[model samples]
Target: MTNYDFVIELFIRVDDAMKNMPKHSQAKLYPSELVTLGLLYAIKGVGERAFFRWADRDLRPLFPGLPERTRFFRLLATHQDWTERFLAEPTVLGIIDSYGIELLHPVREREKTLVREREKTLVREREKTLAPRIATKGKSNYRWIMGAKYGFLLNQLGLIVDWASSWIGTRPRKAITIPSSNP
Candidate 1:
């Protein structure tokens, strides 16, 4: 099964766990749907704007019944108490390795001119605001200096149980960690 399929299953499991929990009735998106969509966005390594742009065409199949991005993000932000349970779970032996998911502009693409420009603008803005002040020198063969890092905390099974992004620095700052676990 694709990673999205597994994540869909994970969301169902989390929803089942929260079945008896107290929640507001006015909430537009379910906790499971919010987590699922966020994971999907992270997995696709695209921003919400991009996701929404292609949601009808590309992501609808994966989501089946996806909600609007505003609703999805609102649920995620306003209902953290419910979602935090997922991130705190460790699906593995106690440690999960993290990686960076740097979204780069395609070196050979002419379509989606507006999207590319917006992504580039955002990246440049992030570079200005988020890049590390201190610089370290290294001369390895793959001497890379990523300005920021973004990736999921997946188990050995390749399931994303968490997601994090960090600024590149001697003392890297932790990014927001998304919940990706069970109760």
Candidate 2:
């Protein structure tokens, strides 16, 4: 199908699904409109400012009442639950995986320590914040790193089913759970 046809079909499906959801009387944008914008944003994979600009210029005809950036973001945040549910529809097969998200480079640790020492007088009265106390040392297949872990569940089509993150030292079993749809 053409891109226009696909978008129309997607909007129809999303609108029908969201029809039974709760609504805010003061909301200027309908759930369908919000979801459509969200899908467009995700597909475009652009930052919020750029997406807003594109929508303002190209999609204004389709979304005549598009709000300003701040209001648009607030609307998205308010309707996040609906969008999440719509995106997480079940699939035939799924995969779960995780990897480390390094917050700081090991080489930078020494520099950080030196900086902290220089600023000791300024932060003397405050608590002594240490890296070990904050981030745990963890090992990945490739290398050892000190950082947090990010986990995700993806469907057969590679869409994110769910995702989470935890401290580096935490095990995936304890940090993440895949909810059973059976009951």
Candidate 3:
């Protein structure tokens, strides 16, 4: 059917995209295996681990030979930049956003000096500068998130024209402009 061909074309496109990516050393999974894994991911739209099993069963015949899970992870970590480039591609003909990837929570390390300065500022403010925080529910009925609403401006091609991220506080934080270095 048409859908089947679409999937096949998408897989081929994924493989083609991998050609431009950086390669790795050491004997492990082939770049083709990594491409198949990525295609399976795009089609299934599931978690990373799920795609591995899917690749083992459904994709094995397509690849005919794939390294074990260890090799798969190794290949994945080694070629992470390719994954980012693959996801960032304007395949949809417009901007797209995805948060499906469950990455490991990074270790939180506090900067002692920065924390001390913030503490000093808090002390200086005292009760005179204390502002009562009011909780407001969003129109969507989603749980109240104590954060500022942020949006990134992307052109029609989906490349980030600019990005602005700010933390929630008494007053709106100033938007910092990110210049496009390419131009």
Q: What's every prediction's RMSD, in angstroms?
A: 9.1, 5.2, 12.2
Would you list the rank order by lDDT, best first?
Answer: 2, 1, 3
Candidate 3 wrongly placed segments (more than 4 Å): 2-7, 20-28, 87-153, 157-183
Best by the lDDT measure: 2
In model 1, the runs with Cα more than 4 Å from the true position are 1-11, 53-71, 77-84, 87-144, 150-164, 170-183
Q: Which of the two, 1 or 2, has more TM-score? A: 2
Q: What are the lDDT figures for the candidates, one per model?
A: 0.56, 0.77, 0.51
159-182 per-residue lDDT for model 3 (tens digits): 754334333322324453433435
**What is the RMSD, in Å, between candidate 2 and the native fold over all Cα?**
5.2
Worst 10 residues of 1 by lDDT: 134-143
Candidate 2 vs 3: which has more lDDT? 2
**Model 3 lDDT, residue 91, Cα:** 28
lDDT by residue (tens digit), candidate 2, 1-183: 965677678888888888886656987677788888888888989999999998888777777778999899888887766776765654767888988888777677678778869888865544365533567667765887778888888888888878777777776534445667686
- Listed in order, each prediction's TM-score against the native is 0.45, 0.64, 0.44
User: How many steric clashes between backbone atoms does each model show?
Assistant: 2, 0, 0
In terms of TM-score, the best-performing candidate is: 2
